[model samples]
Target: MNIHIFQHAPLENDTGAINHWINKGNHKKFYTRLYADDPFPSIDSFDFLIILGGPMGTYEEDKYVWLIKEKEFIRQAVNAGKKILGICLGSQLLADVLGAKVYKNNKKEIGWFPVTLTPDGRDHALFAGIENSINVLHWHSDTFTLPEKSIRLLESEACVNQAFLYETHVLGLQFHFEATPDSVISMLESDSESLSISSDSVQNSEEMLNNLHYSGKSNEILFTLLDRFLAL
Candidate 1:
C-alpha cells in the first residue's frame, strides 16, 4: 500500500512502530511537511493518508496560512474516498473540514490519561483487541464536535470527544497512540512551556518521561487499529 503522511511539525511525526509497520509491509511512504512549505501530493497517489499531530490549533489559519490550503486538500481527499487518519490538531482540521466546530476544551490534557471506549467503540472492529479503557498520550487543548454522520468512539474525563469515526474511512483521534519514547522526548523539548502551566490534566516532564512504558501498549493498539482499518 502507498501511505502518505501529512506532518505538521518536526517533533511530531510518525513513531517507530508506524515506521516498522510500513517497512514490514513494504509499503511506499510519502510526506507533505506543511511546516516547511512542502507541497501536497495528489489524492490519487496514495492509498492511505495519515495526518500527524502539532501544537497549533485548527482555527489558527491567520497565523498559519497553509491551514487554509491544507483544509482544502483534506476536503478533496475526503470527497475522493481516501482512507484518512487524523491525530490531535490533524483531527481538529478534519473535523473543521467536515463542517464540525473545533474549539478549546475546558481543560488542557497533556499527559498519559485513560480514555474509555464508548459502547460503539467497544463494539467496533477497529478496536477489537483493545481494552475498554486505556491510557494514551494526550497533548491537546482543542476539541471538536463530531462531524455529521460520524460515530463517537472514545471519551475521557477531560474531554468528551476523544475519538470519532467518519463514514468508515476517515478517523479522528484526540489523543496520541503513535507516541514513542523519542517522540515524547522531542515533544517535551520543543513545547516545554506547556508543562509550566498549572493544570490537573498536565504532567511534568519527569512524570511523562517516567511513563515511557505506556508507549509500548499504545503502539500495540495503534498497530492493531491500523491493520483493522486497512482491512476495512
Candidate 2:
C-alpha cells in the first residue's frame, strides 16, 4: 500500500513502530510537512493517510494559514474514500473538517492517562484485541464534539471524545498510541513550559519519562489497529 503522512511540526512525526510497520509491509511512504509549507500529494496517490500530532489547535488558521488548506485537503481525501488515521491535533482537524465544533476542554490532558473503550468501541473490530481501558499519551487542551455519523470509540475522565470512527475508513484518536520513548521526550522538550501548569491531568517530565514502558503495550495495540483498519 502507498501511505502518506501529514506532519504539522518539526518534532512531531510518526513513531518507530509506524515506520517499522511500513517497512515490514514494503509500503511506499510520502509526506507533507505542513510546518514547512510542503505540498500535498494527490488523493489517489496513496492508499492510506496518516496525520500526526502537533502543539497547535485546529482553530488557529489565522496564525497558520496552511491549516485552512490542510482542512480542505482532508475533506477532499474523505470524499475520495481514502483510509485516514488522525492523532491529537490531527484528530481535531478531522473533526472540524467533518463539520464538528472544536473547542478547548475544561482541563488540559497531557500525560499517560487511561482511556476506556466505549460500548461501541468494545464491539468494534478496530479495537478487537485491546483491553477495555489503556493508558495512552494525551497532550491536547482542545476537544471536539463527535462528528455526525461517526461512532464514538474511546472516552476518558478528562475528555469525553477520546476517539471516533467516521464511515469506517476515517479514524480519529485524541491520545497518542504511536509514541516511542524518544518521541515522548521530544514532545516534552518541545512544549516543556506547559508542564509547569498545576493540573492533575498533566504529568512532570520525570513522571512521563519513567512510564516509557507503556509505549510497548500501546504500540502493540496500534499495530493491531492498523492491520485491521487496512484490511477493511
Across 67-166, the per-residue lDDT of candidate 1 in tens digits comes to: 9999999999999999999988888999999999999899899999899999999999988867999999999999999999998999999999999999
Which TM-score value belongs to model 2?
Answer: 0.97
lDDT winner: 2
**Residue pairs in steric clash, candidate 2?**
none
**Per-residue alpha-carbon lDDT of model 2 for 1-232, expressed as tens digits?**
9999999988787555788788888999999999999998988899999998888889998999999999999999999999999988989999999999999999999989999999999999888877999988888999999999999999999999999999979999999888889888888878898899989999999999999999999988988899998787
Residue runs of model 2 more than 4 Å from their true location after superposition: none
- CA-lDDT, candidates in order: 0.90, 0.91
* Cα deviation of 6, candidate 1, in Å: 0.9
The C-alpha RMSD in Å for every predicted model, in order, reads 1.1, 1.0
